[model samples]
Target: MIAPVENKPEDVPPAVVDEEEAEDGEDGAPETQGAGGEGKKKKKKKKPKKKKLEQTEPPSIGLSRLFSDGNYPEGEIQDYKDDNSYRTTSEEKRYDERRMMEDIDETYNNIRKAAEAHRHARKWARKFIRPGMRMLDIADGIEDAVRTTVEANGLEAGIAFPTGLSLNHCAAHYSPNPGDTLVLGEKDVLKIDIGVHVRGRICDSAFTLSFDPTYDPLLEAVRAATDTGVREAGIDVRLGELAGYIQETMESYEVEVNGKVLPVRPIEHLSGHTIHPYQIHGKKSVLLYKNEDQTKMEEGEYFAIETFGSTGRGKVVEQGEVSHYARRADAPHVPLRLTSAQNLLKSINKNFGTLPWCDGTSSGGGEQLNHLVSQGIVQDYPPLCDVRGAMTAQFEHTILLRPTRKEVVSRGDDY
Candidate 1:
């Protein structure tokens, strides 16, 4: 069972650890000291206790020892394999399942509509986005643009996934803090993740851009890796097979970001997840590694294919000390005060659909206040980070793994 999100008022964020520098042997084991002379004695140091929000440093081990030379290591890929699974069918049977005619037409129209909205919002981001803008400022602009574009197209503005704006080493879940007023630098690695839902169908996608011209190749590799994942989102594909494809292809590119070869290790804990109506990270997972759970790819299922690349190492550490309350899809229903709070928000969202709100200053504030006034059960406000250094890059696309084919909900000519 999933643990309830706890509310710890006194909790403090731990120091960030960079696992890229960890020392390991070629066999993926921590290296021991060389044999000493008969009279020599080996020394060991005590390990510090890990704090809840302690920051971890990069690993000391070289890529050669973790992964074989000329390739990236696969030490931590097992999580994906373990958490996800699929059925192995005969080759002939796998190829016979295709989308029905009605499904294909539905998918085509959804993709086209989603692509146009995405392009409009992306162009707005490209125009108002710059190095000097604060992260929230950019997010505000993108959100507004997305809502405006979708409404103009006669579409609903449902979020495909939570918008993420992680900067260097902070790969995901790095949004601006309340009252934060900071400026961006030329070296910042800006990763923008956004979504659009039209008429109950969703299209979620992401893009990563930077100020450094030299980092163009890194972006290109990320783009290619995302493409490869989407292209392989076909019926009956093995979970591990897709991950291996990404691992092998990106390693082959040897692109550098922030002075290090792109890390082969994805945020192993997080993989692309299923997207059904009103649900993100739904029941199905399109794992990047092999696993026992081969969730048979069914026709008409929508999925978000996301991938992250790093410069220091493939290993990702949680640098930000932020957390938010999310309702678990599989959790048992509870009779708690949260329902009232949820309803208040739900009503506002129902009306706004695709409209933008400034959280505190909007007329939506009336609706939000009514819930809070009732003393509804609200969890603690999660922490936020203001870290410097490190960079993050990502790409994503929403897709329908059709029975015999695949359709990209967020496909664009430029993609």
Candidate 2:
């Protein structure tokens, strides 16, 4: 709901008053006789009139203005909150109801703050990033920008997960390890997936960057698919139907590389999922291809509506060394024989909790991490890659399905 506009007393102009007054006379009475005993009229002192205040339009309170670069698609904003249309009967309750210790407005503000941090960091990264830069430097730059923008302190607010700088065939889950010497090339297609959270409310979004115009179509396809997903999504929308719309929009475009036309395909296995508090991946998954899953999106849920378009095989497989790891949310308590493993687990719990962390963020504990992985106390995520010599691009936006409207929390002008 839009707040009422109030005008302070200082904002109003003072009233102008005109009164006839005689010099040396009380209460504006004219002197009957002058010093020469002749009746004369004294010149009246005039009060300057105050000009009327100019009328200008009030500042906009639309949701689009919340972010500095927010560009939500048409009709994304609704006034259900003002009209009390968000209320529903008990029988029609959604699967996931809104649960928070604070008020709903405060919750939205927290989420928007996190989204703004992500937007500002990404904006700086997009401008500062260039070819020939090391992947490690790029990741560090983005993460550092996020930390600075959010003013993160401990777990109250910080990076939701490790920044993914997957390039070319590597579709996702690729972040550079410490001392790794992978440099970005001019021809490479880089996918930058960044996450930020405020008080456990995560805003997960990603975009693709390509230096060459030859891969423009690939980027466009993925961005269009993501936009389609965001536009088509709403309360009570079926996940399978949403997938169909995304695939239809994504597969409609083709790119030309070296005079060879290649149709962009949606990555079938890599699907977008819901985001929960302190957890990047929730239970529900949104596929890129058409399916029969009858799960309907409920109100009061946050979703990462992401899509990956590729010019290679539509499916991706795990490859390369594991760099991303996270503590299992439901990890079983198992006695560890090695003290290093126990220490590493303690560090992970204290520092990262269940959020994903990369090797770059860790402090040289490969053996202990391996031991934790063996015990299933931690889960490892290797880089996901398509076929060699292929190119993939991804675009994502986090959305909150409010009772009144769906908020594209991560919507920015860049993507």
Best by TM-score: 2
Error of 2 at 393 (Å): 0.2
Q: How does each model score on TM-score?
A: 0.62, 0.79
Ten contiguous residues with the weakest lDDT in model 1: 72-81
Clashing pairs in model 2, backbone N/Cα/C closer than 3 A = none
Predicted model with the maximum lDDT: 2
Native-vs-model 1 lDDT? Answer: 0.55
Q: Show where candidate 1 strays beyond 4 Å.
A: 1-111, 152-156, 255-264, 290-293, 317-326, 337-389
Question: Please, what are the lDDT tens digits per residue for candidate 1 over residues 235-311?
Answer: 55665677767666555555564476644344455568777654455677655544566556655566788877655
Give per-residue CA lDDT, model 2, range 54-169, as digits (tens).
21122112222343354323213532332235544233333233433146635676778788778778887888899999998999888887887666777788888999999999
